[model samples]
Structures are given as structure tokens and as C-alpha cells.
Target chain A: MTGELAIKNLHVQIEGKEIIRGLDLYVKQGEIHAIMGPNGSGKSTLALTLMGHPKYQVTQGTISYKGQDLLALSPDERARAGLFLAFQYPFEVSGVPLSRFLLQAVKARAPETKAQSNGRPVRRPLGQFRKLLHEKMEILKVDKSFAGRYLNEGFSGGEKKRVEVLQMLVLQPEIAILDETDSGLDIDSVKIVAQGVNSLRGPEFGALVITHYQRILNYLKPDFVHVMVKGRLVKSGGSELAEELEERGYDWILQEVGAASTESAEEKGADPDERS
Target chain B: MSDHEEHLGERKSQGVAIAEKPQREGFERDYNKYDFRDPEQYAFKAEKGISRELVEKISAMKGEPRWMLEKRLEGLEIFLSKPTPTWGGDLSELNYDEMCYYIKPTGEESRSWDEVPDKIKETFDKLGIPEAERKFLAGAGAQYESEAVYHNLKEEWAKQGVIFMDSDSGLQQYPEVFQKYWGTVIPAADNKFAALNTAFWSGGSFVYIPEGVEVNIPLQAYFRINAENMGQFERTLIIADKGSKVHYLEGCTAPTYSSRSLHSGVIELIVNEGAQMRYTTIQNWSTNMYNLVTQRALVYQDASMEWVDANLGSHLTMKYPSVYLLGKGARGEILSVAYAGAGQHQDTGGKAIHAAPYTTSRITSKSISKDGGRASYRGLVKVVQGATGVKSNVMCDALLLDERSRSDTYPYIEVDEDSATIGHEATVGKVGEDQIFYLMSRGLSESEALSMIVLGFMEPFTRELPMEYAIEFNRLIQLEMSGSVG
Candidate 1:
């Protein structure tokens, strides 16, 4: 209940259809949690809802970040409050250079760069900011030409995923939810992106990574691995739980839960609505 | 439930913050601080409404020759005979009787900056015309209300035999050269607005680049309308002779007013054989102004013409710049951008005509509409018979910022030659919530995110502008986008 990112009994609906049902989660300070699920299992849904995407409607329950009611803030306010979400399929925003976008974003997120007297917003010294940007980009191995090209306007899938991680390293949010950040990346790119995210790990940072494949877990070390199925978390344990699912698949857990429900129903000898 | 509605105030403040002119990168200055006002005084003024007597009086005031006087009367007859255009934005709100035909702020154009009127000089100074002209322009003219208040040309260009002056003086000093190509590209009877401009034209730039002499630096002009219910009908004529090249930039801005103003002008460009000319216009009229302008170019053999136009402010604007490729191997291109904010309508486009063999043309238009605004692109591409090997392509892209806005594209193509290749592409899209969320996740407020997206959408046109004009363009757009998202 007092974690960096905590969600309790959350229900989400998109365009009148429920996508996430009774989902509860907790990510503590400096802890990395991985949510692994099959396709359409609402892993991406949970991340988007946390980021306050207007299309994903939160129907019930609560999401609190660092003991604050996160839903009360707009998406930008949430960002300024130190929360970030790396999109699964990044949107291409043409005409905006990556360098300019990053500069403005850094200014907006940092407290010192807020609007000052006479309503004029202040910015950091250009030379200092540019030097820092070049250094971070070099760490991510992004080409200098990428600075001038429109943000993800014509990026390949692997390039898009890497750029998302680069943004995380630049913004350095307190709680980062990376939705399939390693989805389409090649082996080398996957290692590079994971390294960028790994460098940000500290007492000031917490992250919830959502993915369908366990291959990324080899590079990104998760303290806890959770299995999500049909909009609910079916199981949770240490890192070995991911190895079990990767080998045996999800049918064993579904079988156990299905049989358990049927046996309990027979013993009760009552209507289904009352059995709960 | 979340306190969803309680954040409107925050959104509004955030929107307003984006509008406050940010210091340009490394410039450490804001131009919005320089906006000032002056009393609407005049040395001479023409009466309201268009009449034959008023046209004759205007010609007499300038001491025009008999042929020019006769031409003015003929233009008056055409304007009286034609009716107001019924299509393309609302024109019923324009009142001819309530409009003042002309208001001359100064008696004569100042040869030196100090000789200019104090009030008029301050206005242009605030607009940053003098500073920008000093750095890069070959010549510059500033028009206030109805007259050219100040004009100056660099001595180098004067020595190179380039004629840069107000249209009135171009008529008086170089009568033969001015009278030959004037109105030939945009004839008086071409359209109602053209006829109206010819009838009551007053102050605009006239440039004559001699044969084989290229004017490397840009020749620029600035136009401002200061009074309410006033009319500005300026006529611009540019002639680039054989093997000569020139680029002319014109910028317009006006103060906000309670009532409506009308701006109807005619621009004629004659590109002689082997010559090239580009005309760039940045029109930031106040929201109360109704702008209807006719601009056209005639290109001779192996000549080329380009129009780079940006229309960012107006209540209702109807303008479509056109080029006529009259000679073989002539080329034409038009890149236009329009932004329509609250209570504004921008109806603009480009037209290309292939009248000779082996002619090629291209038209690219980008438009954005927000806060109940409407932006439309209406274009035409025609290849006349026997004009073989003609190639034309038209691309139009529109972005609507919010649900209240609207955008549309209407393109007409006529190909008479069998060998011609013509293609057209248009897209109309609203700002996707996904894109907005992406930028917002980066900590940009909703309005700032939207404005950045809009600027990115207009990068093609803005990149073509010079540094000073581009900065001014971005500043105007930021102001227009303020408080637009709530």
C-alpha cells in the first residue's frame, strides 16, 4: 500500500469493454518488477492506464504513486511528478527534432527551469545542456544525425525501442513503466537498451517492465516475476517463477485454478453469486 | 472519483504560459514586449467606399499620366460591375460603405530613417524591420496604412542599376519601365479583387532587376494596418529580366481592433526568359481583417517562379496564388501554409498552369485549424492542349488540433496532353491522443505539446523562411495557440 507505484483492485475499460479486471500491484523503491503475460492479457493496458491515456478508462479502484493519488493528476502533471511510461508502439511526431524535444522536456521536468518572473520560462545554459545531451546520446550510441531528424518519424522498430530507453535515461523519472521496451529489438540492441535502463537503477528509481517473452529477463534482472492471464495476476514469486512459465507454459496454472473452483463449488451446494 | 474537472484552471494557466513569447535560442530577447500603439492620424485621407470620382482623385493626387488615369477609370468600371465573391469563406460580413478607401500617414517617403515620422518609425522599429534590413536586405520598404512612410536601398544595388522604390515613385521616375510590365501578369479585369486593387492601389514595392544582373540579397517590405474599418489596396509589381534572379519577401502585421478591416491587394510577377524569381509573403493580419488578395506570375521560356506564402492571422482569408507557365521549359512551384485559430477561416491554395511544351510544376500546401477554426485547400492544375511532357504534382496535408476544428482539401486537375504525368495527394487528420500523450509524458503541457506538433507540421514552410521571419512566425503562432486547448 506504501510502495513507489501501488495499484489496488484496479479495473480498466477501453471503448466500453473491460480490459483490466481486479489488478493489484506494488513496486517498491529501487525494485524492478516484471509483468509477463500472453498476448491480450492487459499488461500494456495497466501501463497505459498508469500514464493516464484518455482512451483507457479507469472504471474502479485506485492507483497511488509514492503515497499520492496518481489519477488526480493529468498526464503531464504525472510526468512532472516523476512518473514515466515508455510506449509499446511509439507515435511518430514529425517536424519536431529529437534534440529540441529532449531539451524542452528536460527543462519542463526540472524544478529550476519553471516559469519565473514576468511569466517568462527559464532554460539552462545552452552549451551546458548540449554537452550533457551529447554525452547521454553517446552512451546510448545514437547517431548525431538522429538529433536533427524528426522524433521517431521514420525510425525502425528496434530504433524506436532504443529511443524510448534513451528518453528514460534523459528524464530519469522516479517510477518508469516500460511497456515491452524489448519487443522488437535485436540481440545487440536489447543489451544496449537494458544497459541504459540498468544505469538508472538506484534508491531514487523504481520500474515496472511488461513483456510477453522472457528472453529480455536474461539481460534485465527483475526482483519479482508475475504471471498475468485474462486481466488478472494468476501467480507471483521470485525470478524462478518466470523460468517455470517459460518451460511449462500457462496451462498448468489454469488447470489448478479451474479444478479448485469446481471442487469448492460442489462442496458449497449454493448459487454461484453467493459462493463468493 | 478523481477530481477531473478541478484541473481546468491549471490547464488554462499552462496554455497561457506557452503563449508568452519564449526567449529565442541564445537571443535573450522577446519581441512581444515591443508591441506599442500610436494615434491614428493622417496627412491626407480618401473618403469611404469605391467610386469613379475617388479613383480619379487618387490619380490626380499622384499626378499620374493620361494613360494611367484612363487605366484607373477602366479599373473602377470593372470593380463596379463585378459582385463580391460568393464562395470561399463568408464575405457577407464585409461592408463596402463602412470601409475607408485610403489613409496616408506621411506626405512623402523618407530617404533616411531620422526623417521618418516619430510614431511611424517607432512602429517599424518595434516590428524589427530596420535591424533585419540593415543586416541582410538589399533594399527595404515599410508601408503604414495607405502610404510608404520610409524607403531605403543599399548603394551597391543602386549602382548595379536595380530599381527598388515605392510603386508611386516607380511610376513617376521610371515611367517607361514601370508602365510596360505593370498589370500585364495580373490584368485589371482578371478578378473582382484585382480590379478593386487597381482602382484604389496606393503603397507597395516595385522592383526591376536588369538583364543578367542578379540581386543576391533579398528585397523586403513590411505592411501594417493601424485603423479600424480601413481598407488597404496595395499593388506590387516585380520584373526579373533575362538571366536575372531575385527573391522578395513581404511581411504584414496589424493591431487588434473591435470592428472589421479589409485588405485586398494584387501582386504581379513577370519572369523574363532565363530568369528566376521567388516571392515570399508572411501575412499576420489582426483577427478583425478580411484578406482577399490576387497574386499571379507569368514565366517566359526557361524561366521559373516560386511563391512561398504563409497566412497565419485573419478573420476570413481567400487567396490562391497562381503561376502561368507560358513558355517552353518553364517551371513553377508554390509552397503555402495557413493556420486558422479561434473564429478564423483560412481558405487558401495554389494554382499552376502549363501553357507550353515541357513545362513542370509542383504545389505543396500545409494547413492547421484549431478552436472552431476552419482551414481549406482549394487548388487547380491545368495542362493546356499541345503542352506535351508536362509534369505536375500537388500535395496537401491538414492537421486539426481539437474536436472543434475542421480541415478540407479540394483539388482539380485537367490534363489535355497525353504525355503529361499528374499526381495529387491529400490527408486530413486530427492530432492523435497517442501523439499528445507521447509529448505530455515528456512533461510538455497539453497546449505546448499541441503547439510543438503544429510547428513540426509546418516545418517545411518555416525552414524556407529567413531567420528573422522564421522567429517572428513562430512567435505569432505561439500567441495564436495560447489558451486554445481548454
Candidate 2:
């Protein structure tokens, strides 16, 4: 696939329990792709597996980002390669200031700031970095005073999601994967967070947003929405599928797929009898 | 042995009161006399060494006030009575008296930098003490051996009723206040090493911040041990009065020697109501040194105390900076970074006692060990029965560079009240191969990648340090990484 993110036949497992089975996905540049599913449907599983999270064992699949094998890279390497994952449950890294953490993340992506420790590099002083971080934070509705706080520590649920969005905007990752960004946000908070995500859409950046509800989809309006059930994407459609799923619910699709499987099984049994 | 005991008295107590007392006698005495005429000779050293009589003589020679003397005597008794602790790093190789107890420089104290002896001044110059003071520090004091020889303060600070001087000089000048508050936070009997320090306290800084005054710039003390077998005991005491604020920075270095030098000192801080105090230390003791120091502070209502410690050197070091939340709304924090290389063991941590309601504390400790070095974090977070609504968080991270290195954490949490919130997290691991490969693929050498990973591991602590110290600390990490990767 000629796109920012392309995963073909992606099969992933944890402790031999296959969580994402033959998952195929592609997100083009400047497009917002949403993966909607119920709990235990491997939505988060696929998100983590795509980002090179160590626990997810990827098998029989090729995850390519802009024609490079993304599966072969470490999490940080993938992050450096412009693949960012806003974890549904962000890891609390104490003693690391959010500003400093973002600075390192930015410097990792930008080559000019990387200097040997022994050499004196005349880089931007901390004040400028602080100001830039504050500007980004203000854009994301984050308090400026949070620059000094430990990353994700003592953050309210909405605050945590906002911090994730703030990092996504500041780091400017090309393929940002947000897993359940609207899980804990209030209605207004969800809208604000969606607005922040919406602001990052561009030809240079593509996003894969994972959600379990259609409420956020109303605000985001992903160009393509895929339905995932039982570790695989059962159907693919446009943004209308999200509205359809919200209206018809997951049971209708599950029944249709389940009945089709039973009918195929009965036909196969009858063919065997006629052959005998 | 009897004759040796008799000869100990003739030694004049080495006048320095080294780390270990009686058994470290003649070796310390001869070394303190500037015996290295060639300036290029080296001496043999030991790893673990301390003793009791060394404590007694250290107390006796200082001519300490009667109460302090008695406290030291009590400390000596405790040192003899208590068993060596077994919970932290291994202490089996330590030999009491094998270490020089007292090894002060042989010279008269000089108030002016120009008046300091040429040799000592050269050492200080090499360490960049004078230049650092001139460039950034508001005040500077240089201590060699067991006493501060040259001290200076900005005229503005002096005029603002601030007092900064050597601890001994402070006692002599302000005897009443000194006596009233000395050992109030950390009594001699608090620990064996503290007792040892109390017995032979020497060249530490004494700072008094007047009420409602705030010192804009940081005052610094640079301690350098230029002599072989020298024992430097510097005592420091800081008092921040009501609504006052102060920042004190201290750094230490010792010349490369084969024989071991011992450093034991005490630091006591008193933060009055609404006051804030920050103490920062960056120590680079050579591998032939044993550094054991004690530091504690009492935080009054709405006061705060901070300890920013970086331990980059020393063969074996045991130091824990602690804070006591003695008043409501008081706060305390400790940010420490330690690096232990081959033949070094860094056992350092912090303690926080929430004795008042609504008090808070936080401790962030980071350590890295390489090539047979051992780094350990041992800490305590305690909340008394009446200290309701207290909160504390402690995070310890130790990075082992190779298979030969070791890291351990022993944290004690005691919450005597139901309303307290406490959290602790620790991690011990080696540098992941993938992290190294990723950095190497980006064109960094293996050593560079390793250094970057190590720096990243210590980023939590370094990011909190001041700019100059952060730069210096990164350089020290690079130096420690030398010969580590290749």
C-alpha cells in the first residue's frame, strides 16, 4: 500500500494467545482512519502491536510505515520514525518532567539538536524550550504550570488524555495512533480533545484513532471506519458505517456474520453427503 | 600494641581527626606532614575501614564545647556497641583504623584567597573553584584538609544580615545560637557515622539567612583534598529564618592516591516557618576515598527543604540526606544521582519523616553501576500517628551496565495514620540491546550510545540540576563510561 501506515495480514499474539489475527489496515496521508469495536475485540491489541510494544508478538504479518518494515524497530525507534501511540492508559513515569520528556522526544526526532555530551552545543536554552512547550500546551488546553510536573502523574482522566494529545502535537509524529482517547473524557472534554486531534490533520501526518464508541466519531468524522470483531476486521466502510453501527448496534452485524458461517457449514456437510 | 597506644598520644592527634581514629595513627600523621616531596608518588589504600578510638581522639582534639564532646563520647560508645548494618551494600572488607582518621593540612587558616598557601591555591585553581565563584556564585569558600582557609561573601549579602562562614568560626562568633540548635535535628546518637562526624567535625559551612530575606544567587563551597592520606571532615549548618530562602551548593574532589583517605562530616539545617532551603552537592572523590556523611533538616510550618545530591566518585560511600516535617504544610524533597564504577560501592538514599498534618515529601533516586561496581538505594518514608493527610512518593531506578554490576533497593515505609498516601516504585535492569542498536544505527558509536542510554537513565535527576552542574554531571558520566564499553 502506498500510504503512511500499511499493515497486511498482521497477526499478533501474547503468550501464545492470538489477539490480532490477520488484521489488514491502511491509512493514507491526511486521512483520519477510525477502528471501532467492542471490548476484547483486539482494537487496543492491534494498536499496541503496531507501535512495536514489546509484549505483543507479531506473527505472519508485515507492518510497513512509508515502505519501511515497522515490525523490526523498537518502540523508541518506531517513535523516532514518527509513529506515536497515545496509550489508552498512559504510563506514569515519575520524576520525569513533562517538559523535559517532550524536549527529549522532540530532540530525538530532530537531528540538529543531537550533540555529543563532551562537545559544547549551542542549542536553544531551557527557557525557549519551556516557552515552546507552554505554547503547545496552551493550544491543547493544558495548564502551563504542568510543564514542571511529572509526566502523567496526578493527572485527571481528561488531563491525561489532553497530555497525550499535547505530546502528539508537540512531537508532530507522522502516524499517530490514539487508543481510546475519549474513554474517560466528559462530553465537553471529549469535544475539546477531538478538536485538538482534528487540528493535527495534514498531508504530512496520518492518524489511526481507536475507539469503542461512536460519540467521538461524530466529532472526528474519520474518512474510513473499520469494524473489528473477534480479533479481525469483519467489515470495512466509510464514515457512514460508524453511524450505522451506532444505529444498528454490533449485534446485527454479529448475527449476520454468524448465520453466514452456519449456512456455509451446512452446505459443506450436504456436499460431503452427496459425494459419499 | 601497648607501646603503639602510648605513641598515639605523641602523634598530636594528627590535628585533622580523620575518618577512623586510633588504628589509623602513624600513617595519617606522617601523610598529614606533607611527606610526598616528589608530588608524583602514590600510596596504598583500603576499601572498608573505621574504628572507635579514632572517634575519641577526633572529639578530643577539636576542643569541642562540653555538650558536643559528651555527644561525641556517646557516639563513640554507640559505634562500639552497635553491630555493623547488614541490609545495604556489603561491608565485610571494611577495617577500622586501616583508614586515616584525621589528616588535616599543616598550615594556618587564611581569610584572603591570596594569603592561602601557593600549593593549596594551585590545587584549588586546578579544580576551578576560584573561577566558578567569580563567574556565577554569590559567595565562595575553599576548604582544604580539615578547615576552610579562604572564605568570602558578597558585600550585599553581608549587609543584609546574612552570615556565611566556617562552622567552627560560626560557633566561635555566635556561640549561643550555635549551641541551642546544634544536633537538634540529627543527634550524634542517630547513627554510627553521624556520631563519628560529631566527634571530629571540622571544615563545614555555616549559613544563616535572616528573616524575610531571600538570597538571589547560590553560595558555594568547594572542598578539595590535595594531600595523600588526608581526612577531611567539614561540618555544615544552615538556618533559614521565617519567610527566608537560600540555596547552598557544595562540591568535593580528591587527588588520585593509592592509600585511602576518609571523609566524614555532618550537615544540619533548620528551616523556620515559611522559609525554603535547597542544598546541592556534586562530589567527585577519587577511587581511593571513603566518604560517609550525614545531613538532616527540620522543616517548620509551610517551610520547604531540598537536597540535590550527585555522587560520582569515591571507592565506598554511605550518605543519606534526610528531612523532618516538624510543622504543618511543610514539604521536603530529595533528588539524588549516583554512579559507581569498578571497585566502587555507592549506598545512598534519603529519609522523610512526616510528623505534622498535611506534610508532604518526595524522593527521586537514580543510580548506575558498571564493571563490578554496586549501587544501592536504601530509604525510609515514615508518617507518625498524628500526621494526618500526609503524602509521599519515592521512585528508585538503578541501571546495571553489564553482567558484573549489581543494583539493589531496600525501602522502608511506615504509615501510622489512615489518611496518608504513599507510593513507591523501583526498577533494576541493564541497557537493552535494542536501545543500543537503535542509537548505533543512527551513527553513534557503541560507547556514545551507551553513554546516551546512561544519561537518559539519569535524565530524571540531571534535568533537575542547575545548568552548570547538569553539564558537569554529563561529563562525569562520560568519564565513567570510559573503558566501560571498550
Q: Say which candidate scores most in TM-score.
A: 1
Provide per-model DockQ scores: 0.66, 0.06
Error of 1 at A101 (Å): 1.8
Error of 2 at B230 (Å): 9.3
Query: Which residue ranges in model 1 land beyond 4 Å of their true spot?
Result: A1-3, A115-120, A256-276, B1-40, B107-153, B223-231, B252-260, B484-486
What TM-score does each model's chain B reach against the true chain B? Answer: 0.82, 0.77
Ten-residue region with minimum lDDT total, candidate 1 chain B = B22-31
Pairs that clash in candidate 1: none
* Residue A79 accuracy (lDDT) in model 2: 74
Best by DockQ: 1
List fnat, each candidate.
0.93, 0.04
Give the deviation of candidate 1 from the true structure as CA RMSD. Answer: 10.3
